[model samples]
Target: MTCLTDGEPSATADTDTDTDTEGELLLRVLTAFLREDVSGWRTRSTPVRRGDGLWLRLPVATRERSRGAALLMPVLDDGYQSTYAARLPLLRREPGGAEFVDTAGVLAALRDLADPVDRGGFEAFAVECQQELDALRLHAGTRREVESLLSERYGVDPGSWTGLAGGLGYDTLAARADHPVYPTSRGRSGLGIAQLRSYAPEFHPTFALRQLALPREAVTVGGGTESWLSPRAAGAPALEGSHLVLPVHPLTADGPLRDALRTAGLEGRAYLVDCPGPDVVPTLSMRTVALASDPTRHLKLPLATATLGLRNRRTIKPGTLTDGAAGQRLVEAVVDREPRFRGVILHADETRFAHAGHELIAVLLRRYPAGLEDAVVVPMAALMCPAPGGDRLLIDHLADRFHDGDTLALLDATLALLFDWQTTLFAHGIALESHQQNISLVLDHPAGGGGSGGGAGRTRLRLLFKDNDGPRVNLARLRDVMGQQAPARTEFDDRRIFVDGDRPVLDVFTTITLHLCAGSYAFGLARHGHAPLERLLRLVRERLAEAVERLGTAPGEPGALLRAHVLDAPELPVKAMVTAGTLLSKERSGAADINKHYTTGPNYLRHDHPRQNYPRRNYTRPTGTS
Candidate 1:
């Protein structure tokens, strides 16, 4: 097989905590720990409102009342009311008085106060956080180079490139930003600095895939790979038996796949091909790579790295390939039948590939439909991420370019389109994990009439969704909407995708779609002084109410329950991402699905508190600190 080559020149360390990158990892983690209260930290702590923001006086169990840690948080305006600013530090209070602590001090204090059961996990996470910080520092120079390239290439018009190029460009931009919740998002647990430089998207690495020859009889196969597979690209091997070629990630080829092949006693049946296969570049999700020859075609391969959490592997499970395709078909049926979704929502075709029933040996092909070459496709996450210059946000650039410099109008249009599709899907018994990363906005001017920051009124918007393996689908209701002959009747290998009750369905919608996707941008925009958090949330509530009303409010139905739980309830369900994704095990957390573990958080959508959003400023300071 092809040897792993260093894909790009390594970048040097460059960091500025004030504008970009992990200046606030420790504080962000602590804020989430308290807000989720997964370990009884919030109830024990006292909250003090300092100016517009809220500060948590954390109890130091080892110290007397005179000594404690106080963390300032950015007040949110939607469901899951608490959040932290990445630009802010932490405050340490003691008998000698309160002063801001450095990153190391925050980590030591957190370690000192952590519970015995959670201490190990917390320490592991802390290590990952530091690694993530270091990685970002190394990535800082390369990130600026990428921004410069895109800026110089695109000039004042972002839509100048084809849809696929624009989408890939925006994906690179999104990769540079920190995750709103996962504090150690950039940490690649199994990879060293060199490996990260070769494979990670932030580095913009392009490398060839390693090929393996597997006996046709020994592996389970799905969609066809004949059209793209070639002698020049994937080595035309003269095998003695009937064998099929499987494209493997260069990294996975060296680690898990070799071991798995040996364990399965297929040493003689499958052999590695000594050829550099189709050159590919990584997307935001490192495991899924885009073909360098034709980026429209993406290959999802198994990887040994862990991101988001130490326990969360990047390997592609055997069932995931088919299960994800099945979910895509079901969603396709919904989009086809729903008149409102016509020309408004599009899905990536993920129906082809082959698998050996092993996580490391599976491949799923992602094909993008035509017509994207003309529009600008950007993931929702990229809009709010820190911009390339480290001065203005990405949304600022988009707003100034496409929306006539009106950020509020751009956000309003986005929310209107998002709610229309998402709410309708919920009404039809499908709740997708349409977080910012999974969803993209397709924007184009009517009849190609607008450009150079002049297309404000005629801009048309659509939603493009991908990664459909984890949605909660009401099978019976889906079949009703799609009819008996529709593909909605397809069975999935992952039964977690099928939900029997409304609670589970609503949980996915509330936690992922509303809180993570919608609420995240709302908070980001508010924190950046784009608009009042309450005003944006009021728009959210109104849009949600309109969707519910449009869907019919039959009592106890999905729409009715969604309105009640999200708009009226004081506490809303939120995924305990840190606990489930990193700190705890299934047995200890008692989580049926580690990704779905839930906890109650304050619902800021409640109409009772109609106030102005907090002004943008440093939140780490004490009540009266100058």
Candidate 2:
């Protein structure tokens, strides 16, 4: 059997030029800053009238505020920067006026800012953020080096390389893996630069998994079937009694996990089997790995890393596995019951294994949607990733499929599917966290081949959801819809689903899926001059209107209530990451408390103010009727 430390280098050799590495570091920091700004974490003065656009002002004295403003200077377009600079009296008093505070100047200003005693946690967060930035920069350099090495050895351009002839390629996966906005949000805190390169999807490294045998008594297993537990034994002896096979990521195997196994008295009882087949490829989520031989089956493993301010460890509590199993059943029932949601694939957890009360060794086995083998499946984030050796976004690759390369048509198609799928799920009492990474898009020619090369009908787009852990159901409403069979409680009974209001459900779905996912994508398109942000939002509104009509809700049904909420709500609740970070620091909370942080923000979808004599319906009515 191959040991965890066998045949691997301890540290990566540094070959990157200092300038390039520093530039990459700056990009990572700026991306995080941009996320905070767009998410409404930073405060800005009211817009003042400018030449063509409105001008925003930032208080120069507030060093905390200035840090975000300064970072924004580098990534934002000239027009945006100018708008922020215009009419700022403080900047006007500085040398060379506002124009002098360029990207470099902003960086310099940030360096001069001092940390306050009250912001000790923020100071620590800043250090971690910088470390993550440095790690990502190193990862990027390693990718380039690997690309060059492969190119020279294989006599082909690796950057433009495609995988398996006509199938989906690694290029798309690689591009999407390195998140454009927050690449280091999921940095492995304890990992060195070389280990980060080894495990991170951006570097495109693959390695064999280490296997362990857990006696049936020591592990709590939940799934539809036991067959899912089959493992590639790789010469390891079979257990004398009932045992569940667990395949662990190599990094986890070397750390605390190995020590845990030894402490559990599994050293002699469990065989340390080598993975015999192909290596596992990490996906956009560093913890989830897909088998190289079979892409359809993915194994979600716990890792000792943190991303987006949440630790990567999956095993936290005991009831979570039970909740996951129950949630899967509930989602499967929804898909079967709703015809509009038939195409919405929930990559349900087929199996789960964990020691009761000990979540350190937890693992979930999930399968790709059935009958989608030929479809070009990619994470929604891939649409925003830059194409190979070009500034063009990956969505540009699908331009030929639409009429005159109309991006609006593509947006329309995608939004329509999203609206239908999400609305149906909401109506059935499930709120999906359909963020870009959790959701995937499957693009293909329409099922019977009717359209020409340049038309709206040429290609079809379908939405597939992963990470079933995100679906939350309102048990009260769920029982109203599903009758006696509906589950009254699950592991996530308190946290996952809203217990009282439809507005909270709508808020969660809209914040994560609409505002964050669609809004970010629209902003990216607008930033690149691909499409107008207003037009995209209008399309979203139109699609929501259609979804309401499609569901044919009466005046007071959940469907109608959600539709009204989407169309008429004055503001939506947006999860405040910065506030959450502060709360996390102050409370010293664990990762489970991450979702509890939210603050209200303006609803971009609602363009019209309330008018007298307009119909108002109660949102508190029971599920089905007016």
Candidate 3:
């Protein structure tokens, strides 16, 4: 036996809010999608004619609100038939930049400014709201009542959202919308979020939805190629656009989640990666794949050769990457260049990655992979996860101990494998939607991959990774991707999004610990601890020092990139970062926010090579069910 697993749980602290590495990264990318003019909030004495209808961006808020909080506030009026509210919270700013709710006070102020006609419209709208509520056939009362109605009214599913809403005692929907103490672009939209959360939800046509909300026009009756969880069912119909998969519940709090799930958990990957596929986007591909075998088989292609976001759905949606020729073009580009870049894992088909630069990103990766990369290719259609093994709870292999060392060594190997798979996203302007289920564990014999000396020289062995099909990388997470600026490296900033929360240095640390260290733990803590943060930092320090010594002061992007690695020492200046880890052996429940993303254990093993015979998670959903 390599090493015994560490059943001990880590200690944790109350963090009303934990820093979201990916959310910060995405802030940079989202800006490109839509820009908000801060000037809109100010009273322009000139009051130049604004957009014809009151331009509504965000709801009026003042307090901290959770799912369905919008329903609580009275919809106020402006001069236009439609009221105008900007996305920005109306009143005060919340800490951590949560979206502030536009409060009644803000509405009153807007109402006062509006021409009487618009004000009348607001009043009329408010009146209609009551009628709408009275007619709610599913209104059972309490937050739970509202939640039930949501599932009934809208085919939403229950997952981690349930736990979140459950924590709030939100059986009834709030009458008003509260201001986001800190608005999260990373958060879900309107009732869509609530529906998945506390209750079944309904969408008022007027409510503007954000990313991840179920689209009004998604779903097809028997049109999509459906398979069944049971043998008897055929493809009944596929929900149009991105269908709801399991709540990307992952192991958020390392200490507790790990103990509960008994897997190292995918929390680190969750914060470190964005999903890699495009969301409800259009694929301009010209290739015409057979509707039936086309999508399924296409999805099976090697990661280096396919677009992950675009699934073979019975129906299609806008903003989602399309399946066919255009995607083929991008896929072909990356595949062709694989050798040039040493090795590459390409994920383009998933709907979540719509905004990740399609071809351009491919080109950029083609360049970098050629320069620096320890490559491995996993052709798996597993559940969404970050760490490599989370795709499968490959327990079968864990029991087999054919070698020496310990589980810690096995875990390190596991992490290195997952990191490489996930890092591909950053190369392509995408993020790995690495929750737990997304990874898989595999057994690899070094000789099987092509012989003893592994890595770039040979296949080394197969490591687990999900086949492309999960959430797309939110283009918005560029901020977190470009952690701490590299003083001397201009190249480091080339792909970096300066705005939002882009911080590449921190991202690296997250990747190594969460993804790498977790794998180590699986084998046992002993082997994994060898590559402790201090040791890793030392390695980086040595690399940087050597580079500077030889080059006599680094220059440009190369210098910056190197500087970022050194600066991204596991020990960062942020107090929030200091608390990333908790004490070991503490028995506790995982945090409400982070608990859902726990990775399954079987997919990886500490010190164990990737397991081979353990590929599964490729189960096609049963037909006729949401």
Candidate 4:
């Protein structure tokens, strides 16, 4: 049963509201500032005598504005400050009064708090934040209308949609959700309001894919795509002499790709096709889209937009296609060898595609395996989004279908599957960037073959993973498992993918999987009163302990290090997403890769407090395993 009452509000209410931008933005910035302990916030800030919850007065050195203080709610698994503490004012200390501050004021205070001030970075970040707020406000009304429509169409009668269509529908809902940590995630730099509606998934726009014809000798081709680019397909234009067809995103065809052709002196040789290709709709990733006629075939094209940060452009770099395919091959080999992972782990066939060896011009086709028309696939990010009308979460619908509305049980089952797969991969020396957006949960039709949505209670859970370009690999450990002669390989064009130490592996596991995927849910559920934060965190630890026992926690083993780093450590690593993703340059941030910078945060799994002394279990190998 769902723990929330009919009148109760959703955990995401603060972030989803049409107005109240200031309050939501304040919470987002404050949570990041405090959780990251930016400029020694934890050590320097003093606690206030608040009656309801913990509040702190931050010492921001600013002459233009008054001092600011924030109210924080601590999560139990990781010390991430809660982002849903709504109606809590960021108080400004004035001579005769204290009043709430605007979002700009709050950001300005935060900018002042930084040591060796980064005025330029903070100013740019502020601009993005305003852009994000505008976009969020612009989307607010349309988002509700879309959610209502989806609820009426699918939520009431899910059987109407096939599994793939339903998955894309859920992806549209997920597109409305914000990133857990990044405050300016909604900021799509270089995109105007019209472009947002035209190209963004949240708008649910369906437009025809554009095409360009390049010289046959000037392009690089990967897998076979003759059928996709043939003259007879989708009324494609007849190719000129010695030319190959290239599918391009509508946004890129007229913008950066056109510029790229001119820069490469191929404008005369290569020309844009006047006729449109197949109709396609954007997915959660924005750049990747599925065909309107055949949902199974997806095209991942390079778009000329920036999300997350100005520096993070959505373009495919040279060699990215081959490297992504290689990563997929490595993971597929591991799954084939491990009996527990055989049927439950799935991959999209990304071996077919072509690019012009430029970031601005490329396309990768991802083909889903056949026979998914009768399953329910939901992205992990969509699970927590408020269902239509904001009464309960979308996960409640699944809970009602499978667990008799037992949301806690659904969460438990999900956590079990996640830890089992993640820790097993860790043991095998692979660290997937399994963020909520990249991974989706596929619920198979119940035994006896019923409709995709309405089925028996007992359905199988499988994970569908895509975007294989970001996983980190411990090459030496993988060699031990696959043997030196095995064809499985982790070699990629990106140097950051290979790591020789346990720290990098642990960093990815804890930050992406544990914090973003698991902890985000736990904290969200607790905020909605589904379960206590401690109880949910205990469930996570228990599941992790079980995985550790199965992997065998002997000294110098993977499990031993995993256990020590995740469970027994005093602090866990958290990605400084705002810092590295947007705020600072590589020189200023001192980060080699923009995505890899981290800061140590308090570990909630450890119980060193005087009141609590949870017993640690002795981990040993399970019999007949390994």
lDDT of each: 0.69, 0.54, 0.24, 0.70
lDDT of 2: 0.54
Query: What C-alpha RMSD separates each model from the true structure?
Result: 4.9, 9.3, 22.4, 8.1
Error of 2 at 389 (Å): 3.0
TM-score of each: 0.87, 0.75, 0.28, 0.87
- Report the candidate with higher lDDT, 1 versus 3: 1
TM-score-best of 1 and 3: 1
lDDT string for model 1 (433-516, tens) is: 778888888877757565534555577778888888888877676666556744433467787788786778888888887887
lDDT, candidate 4, 217-303, per-residue tens? 777777754566554453544564457787888878767876888776787887777778889988998999999888888899988
Error of 2 at 383 (Å): 1.0
List candidate 4 segments past 4 Å from native.
1-19, 48-78, 81-87, 91-100, 112-117, 151-161, 224-226, 231-237, 449-457, 485-490, 607-626
Candidate 3 wrongly placed segments (more than 4 Å): 1-336, 340-403, 406-437, 446-459, 463-554, 565-626
TM-score of 4: 0.87
Model 1, runs deviating above 4 Å:
1-23, 48-55, 58-80, 83-88, 91-115, 152-161, 224-233, 446-453, 476-490, 610-615, 618-626
lDDT of 3 by residue, 327-357 (tens): 2233334345345323333332332221112
> What's the CA error at residue 326 for candidate 3, in Å?
10
Cα lDDT, model 1, residue 169: 70
